[model samples]
Target: MKIPKIIHQIWSGIDGPLPQEFRSLGETWKRDYPDWEYRLWDNKKMVEFVKNEYPEYWFVYQKYPFNVQRWDAIRYLILEKIGGMYVDFDYESLQPMCEILENKTCCFSLEKEVGSNLFKVFNNAMMMSTPNHPFMQKIVKFVFSRTTLIPQYTNKNLTIFNTTGPYALIRLYETLTTEEKEDVYLIPAQFVSPFTGLEAEEVRLGVVNQKLDDCLDNAYAVHYYVSNWVKTNN
Candidate 1:
């Protein structure tokens, strides 16, 4: 089956109103993918979703120590149940998603090394798949399995990454059977990512040497690395 034409984005709304610039970044997705369905989820909607569609995982979802972990978990469940695409708000759309996806039914954006992240190669920042895809099935299953396991990282970000972020996704993805890996595409970094987390910060700080336009010639989107998960205040 082909991937659905929908986009899912979430915000906790804990930081007062969603920032105007964030909305502008998201508007790029809307403008580029005019026909795609758009779904913006908040903390309450996310909680209600779990209580409704994934009641079995409610305890685990609530038990997550970090809000970012819950953010990571919901993307998987959203794609598993709703299918389509989950694009982080920081990922600015440069072109229509369909054109960039190139007819793939399932695709995960790949990133270059991310500091100390073990699974930096496969980023969940932008993901596309049909609903009920086999890979996503295993994704949610793996998420549930980690509910009781504790990663021993001293840094909170590392802990979240290891447990429910890209680390967990790639770890589970690698263990899938050959048949289960079928139709799952690992997209190259330059196509969508185009920068490491450090490099992204440089871009954000406006200190990068290379002209931004020079690097994005082939990019369909650019992840600004807003990284709300890294902030504790919220």
Candidate 2:
């Protein structure tokens, strides 16, 4: 069955913390799929609509010390409450991601096993899942319930709450059966080129042509890792 395409976007603000990496991702949705019904979450009406329509979706404020991690928590809420495909601000798409769903409930990215602190980094940038999915529900629960006390380890580079959300989900994803995992497509490199270190010849080949221009053409979305791009332009 062909999956119905429903695209969504959220802008915190022009000078909001996400910067261009986030807006760039949103721009891709507008540019790549003109037919897509895009929605921004910052407006009061839209925020109310999402909450009223799907109360299961809950968002937390970036209060005091928690300011740094609120964005991640907001994403968790949207994915669970709205229950469709959602992308983070940093994610960029090279093609129509809707074609990949085939109507399946959820999709997400997988970073090759990388460990930082206890939290493993999974591709939370682009996630597709339904509210009814058991696995996804479990993840939403885990994220919401956890208390994110800053870690005491100052020498360490990573923190638990910072990466724990994505890491836990990725770890869980790894354990799924082949058939189970198939329900969630692992969007190949060509489609979701995460701007991680690219020392490998193959990765360079895939993304190196005409570089930014080529990226703009093929990418339905691009996860801009750099914040300056957004701050300077928008």
Candidate 3:
């Protein structure tokens, strides 16, 4: 049987370094769930989409924007155009993402509390779905729609973006139905990310047992935060 394919998007400029990322992803898949496939999507599509859809917003990307809100919007727009999950280059997939978000229209890491400024702030680092998912479409469109007006208020760079918390909360609130909103799974702050210094133990546990069947066996991916791949045997 052919393994199901999962999509991963990155910038076109990183083509040379893509091999290392592919190797990392491949190793994790082989070690954990060998029956999965990963596909790469680059910045070309996003660039075109941004130009055609929101020409005035093009310069923002040139400034090297780090805001998750805007990045997440681009990711979902691209995902909607093609179909599948979009992951950040810095992320390492310890397991197939589908394992965690199975049958769900869309899923992204979530912060535990409202005031947390941690990584779960923006769903940008990782996002999952098949295609044309209603909620995901709504959230992406809302973010993109606001892009045109962003420059009117602030310059190309804004601190509001470095933390995706407030925007994510608002996006979730806007897109989900009352029940979906209330019952949406946060995927346990640790399962999704270990952004706090206090979460070191949790990351150690994941590193110690980097297998699909171990630590949050139901999780689909592991972010690892670090850009390079390394493993220490326990």
Report, for every candidate in turn, its global Cα lDDT versus the true structure: 0.82, 0.53, 0.51
> In order, how many clashes per candidate?
0, 16, 0
TM-score of each: 0.90, 0.64, 0.59
Model 2 residue 223 lDDT score: 54
Superior by lDDT: candidate 1 or candidate 2: 1
- Candidate 3 residue lDDT tens string, 1-234: 111245555545432445665556545644554544455445565667778865765665444344334445566666655566566665555554445565565566753344655433544566665566665566555554445344443532233342232354454555567776543344555565534323433563664435423544544555545432122110
C-alpha displacement of 23 in model 2, angstroms?
4.5
Top candidate when judged by TM-score against the true structure: 1
lDDT of 2 by residue, 1-234 (tens): 232245555555534554654566577767766775566665454446546754554342322133224445555566665565566555555667555566677766644333453533555666766665666766656555534443443421233333334555776777778788767666654456534433223343655545545434433445544323223321
Clash count, predicted structure 1 = 0
Q: Rank the candidates by lDDT, best first.
A: 1, 2, 3
Which sections of candidate 1 miss by over 4 Å? 113-120, 146-151, 208-211
Lowest summed lDDT window (length 10), candidate 2: 60-69
lDDT of 1 by residue, 1-234 (tens): 388889999887866677888999989988998888999999899999999999999888888778788888899999999889899889898877566576677899988555675553787888998889888888888776645356588878777778878887878888878776767888877878887777788888887565666778788889988887676832
What local lDDT does model 2 show for residue 38? 67
Model 1 Cα displacement at 210 (Å)? Answer: 4.3
Whole-structure CA lDDT of model 3: 0.51
RMSD of each: 2.6, 6.2, 7.4
